[model samples]
Target: DVEKELEVQIGMKQEMELAMQMLEKDICDKQDVLVTFRQQLDDVQSLNHELSQKVQGSDNVIRQKNEIIARLEEKASQMNCTIKQLEQRLRQTQSSCQSAEEANYLFKQEFGEKILRLQNEVDLLTKQRSQLEMGLKDKKLSLHSDPHRINGSEQVKADQQQMADMKKELEQLREENLRLRQAGEESPSNGIHQSSRSSAEAEKERSTLERQNVICKLCEEEVSVTRLKRRCHNCQAIFCSQCAINELPLPSSIQPVCVCNPCHRVLLQQYSTTPPP
Candidate 1:
């Protein structure tokens, strides 16, 4: 009976040990699973951060687009007002000239020039109206071309965001070009064009001048375009890169500065102003 009792106790101990081993293994498995879950959570958080940045960028683009649209609408209204005023002026001028023979003779003499100017103004207004119409059309086309409408509903926002960014950039470029044109018309001095020299000698001279016109040797920023980018470091007044370089101290090892015909006198004045050591 004692032997049987001893045998039963031994069997119980073995079963308990086996249960303990199984419990230990289960705990280890749970720990491994927890570690994997932590890693996955970290990855998900990082992805969320990136997605947030993209979302913010998209929002900024949308805001810029709305601003551009508002500006375009304002410009359109102004053009319409100008057109009405011009038409009134033309009618009044025509009526005044019709009654007097002397006025009519002078009007006839000036009619060709006056008519040309009026036609030019009308054509400009028509073009401005057409541009606004096209911009509106582009916006509509972009809105409708969203591929997301065919797919899942979630992508619609992203597509709209992308289209808005593109339109904003286009509007900015157009506005800049318009401002440049207006500035050119107002100030003839601001209008500068690169002369296309055909001859090799002229091309060489042009190339030399072009190289000198760069603001910084390292960045290769053009002095002419530099005015639009930023003010000159030396004069605080904006000049093309070539103009800036011309003001730089010439190295004994390097050649003399290449300047445009107009800038030559300025360069001479600058040289004369330098006090001798």
Candidate 2:
């Protein structure tokens, strides 16, 4: 009986040991599941943070695009205004040109005979001037090659006197050209006269636009625009008014326009050579 009791106690002890072992294995399994759940939660939080950063970056790009759009709209508005102003000026210029053309036709009809006679004289003078220039050049080259030619001093004096005479003739022609144009310019043609006056004033004002110091091509004088420098209509060269004092009619316009003296001279020669219409 004591041995039976001992066996039963031993069986009970073995059953308790088995139950303890099962409980420990179950606890380990529960711990592993909890650790897996914690890892999943951390991964979800990281993904949410990444999505927030991407959203903020997208907002910045959208804002920049809006600013660019506003600037473009403003620039387009300014350009439209500029185009409108240019169109207005074009219309005014066309109207002024038409009035000048009518006046020019009247002047041509009135002075046709006188102009022909004057033009014939101009032709004779220009031919003489050309011959004189050629002769002077030939003499200069000869003197340079052979220093022993007749005293350069005497020859030079005669040449200078001849040049002076030619210069006088040229000046007369220049004066005649100006007088002819002025007659047309001063004609009491309503819009034409006013347009000519305004054009001259505008030319003077426009010439003063350059801010930086510029040297006059003819005089080589440093000029501050407000006082003197002007552009020649014929040559498109800048010079002091003193050097470009002559006024002549441009081929395209009937009104007398400012031109450099050299250009005025050349223009006279060319006009003299051309046959009258």
Candidate 3:
């Protein structure tokens, strides 16, 4: 009985030792799991810090972009204002140009009417002078034919006084003609300065005048009929058919063109000398 009791006690001691070993193994496994959990927690905290920094950098970039957009918008507003101002100035300039054109047209019409009236007066005066000259010649012939008649002697003295008066009137007419010519020359220059702002505009006005058939340069008469007027090829001067002195050959044209006396003289002087063969 004692031996059996001792074996039972030994078996009980072995069971206690096995239970302790199992408890220690369970504790070590639980510590390893805690260590792994701690490492995972540290990794998660580092990832969170990196994400916050990235978020802050993105916010800073967005703010800078917003500032640039605001500045660009301000610049756009200024440019629009400048564009409006330029448009207004352009409109004003156009208005001024139109007004200048109207004034120039009126000035040209008035000047043309004055020239036509003056030309008519000059033609009438010339006709009257020719009639008076013929009358004086007839009176002189009658005086020579009838020398002894008392009435004829008195008539001859009266005709001599009339001739002296006509001479004075002719001198006055010549002076008036010179004054009118000088005025005509100065008028165009004054009109150009007052009305034209650009060379292109002045050229356009001159072309318009040429197309309108204003006057003959030689006769100072209005050139209303195309058939009666001729233009010189060399000098581009307009003259009446009666005033044209000759026809000249031009390299560019097939037909001969009429020329004024001055241009014909110039051409003769230029080509009269024979070339060396």
Candidate 4:
């Protein structure tokens, strides 16, 4: 009986020990599972925080993009308004240009007639001036031949004064003709193309006048058309370079200047009598 009881007690003690070991193992496994769960929770929380920051940054970027879009829209609106204003101004300018063209055409027609009449008068006056100059030359020659002719001296003086008045009138008429012709040809209200065309016509007129009317005053060599580029600085008469080759000093000039033969001779005589101060 005592032996059986001892065996039963040992078995019971072993079983209890084994059961307690199993319970402790189960407890350790539970604690490990809990720790794993806690670690996983911590990882989840960190990931959530990072995701929150990214979302916030994304939101800020989206807001900035919206602001930029709004500003761009405002700029576009302002640009459209400016374009409208420019278009309106362009239309007004085009209309004004058309009206100006019509007015300019009418003005040219009226001034054309006036300019033609003035040109005819200038030609008549020029012929009259030549006759008067010839008459004066004849009178001067008669006086030189008969030095005692005091009676013709007063008449010569009167004729000279009349010639001077006629010359002044002729110069006035020429100026008026030039002004009327310029007005007929050129207008400030004209377009740039019109202005350029007018300038070309003026150049053509200048060339024609040079060809028809302007002859070398000194060269007298009558070969119909000679290019007259040089003008006498003293007498302002157009001449060839060979005709006015001499240089002389004048009171108005800082240096020696090219003068016509007649002007140069007069300057020489004056200098001989009274030297430059």
Which residue pairs does candidate 4 place in steric collision? none
Clashes of each: 7, 0, 0, 0
Q: Which residue pairs come into collision in candidate 3?
A: none
Q: TM-score for all predictions? A: 0.35, 0.41, 0.42, 0.54
lDDT (10s digit) by residue, model 2, range 136-199: 8888888888888778646866986887897798678767766776676677433443234576
Q: How are the candidates ranked when ordered by TM-score, highest leading?
A: 4, 3, 2, 1
Mind giving the per-residue lDDT tens digits that candidate 3 earns over 42-98?
A: 999999999999999999999999999999999999999999999999998777666
List candidate 1 segments past 4 Å from native.
97-277
Per-residue lDDT tens digits of candidate 4, residues 52-143? 99999999999999999999999999999999999999998888877655655565455545544554565566557667777889989999
Better of 1 and 2 by lDDT: 2
Q: TM-score for model 3?
A: 0.42
Task: Give the CA lDDT, 0 to 100, for residue 210 in model 3.
Answer: 51
Candidate 3 positional error at 4, Å: 8.7
Q: List ranges where model 3 is wrong by over 4 Å.
A: 1-19, 115-277
lDDT of 1 at 273: 45
User: How many residue-pair clashes does candidate 3 contain?
Assistant: 0
